[model samples]
Target: MLLETTPDTSAFMIAGYTVAFVVMGLYVASLFIRNRNLDRDAEMLKTLFEAESSPSSKKEAGKSAKKPAPKKKSVSKKK
Candidate 1:
């Protein structure tokens, strides 16, 4: 009697590889987007820090650094 053999699994293998590559590409794209956003945030923070550290801001900060002395309150005798 003649016996039937199993079919090839190359199609399944190709499909699995396709899925894996797609997932990897998506992950890489997300990483790139995140990096770009972080770069933009860093630039904004740097500019803000520079602005705050400028001479005018420093002068203002110095002027506001001194606090007015607190006055002592007089207490009255209570019954």
Candidate 2:
């Protein structure tokens, strides 16, 4: 009886490698997007905190020395 030779499986191996590279590329891209979003959030929160603190502190400091305006007295002459 003659023996049959098996076909090479290199094509299947190459396809698997391609799929692995594509998946890794996608994962790296997602990580980059998440890092950018976190940086933006941090910058926004810092700005918000500065905006919230400055005006209130100034108003509080002014409150200690500020006086209310004097009211004018009404004069009634017989008309």
**Best-fitting candidate, measured by lDDT?**
2
Clashing pairs in 2: none
Cα deviation at 67, candidate 1, in Å, is 25
RMSD of 2: 20.9
What digit string (tens of lDDT, one per residue) describes model 1 on residues 1-79? 2676777999999999999999999999999777766766665565555555555646666444422222222222221
Alpha-carbon RMSD, each predicted model: 17.8, 20.9
TM-score of candidate 2 against the unseen true structure = 0.58
> Tens digits of per-residue lDDT for model 2 on 1-79?
2576777899999999999999999999999777766666665565555555556757766544432322222322212
- Give the local distance difference test score of model 1: 0.61
- Regions of candidate 1 where Cα sits further than 4 Å from its true position: 1-3, 6-8, 57-79
**TM-score of decoy 1:** 0.57
The lowest-lDDT stretch of 10 consecutive residues in candidate 2 is 69-78
Which residue pairs show collisions in model 1?
Answer: none
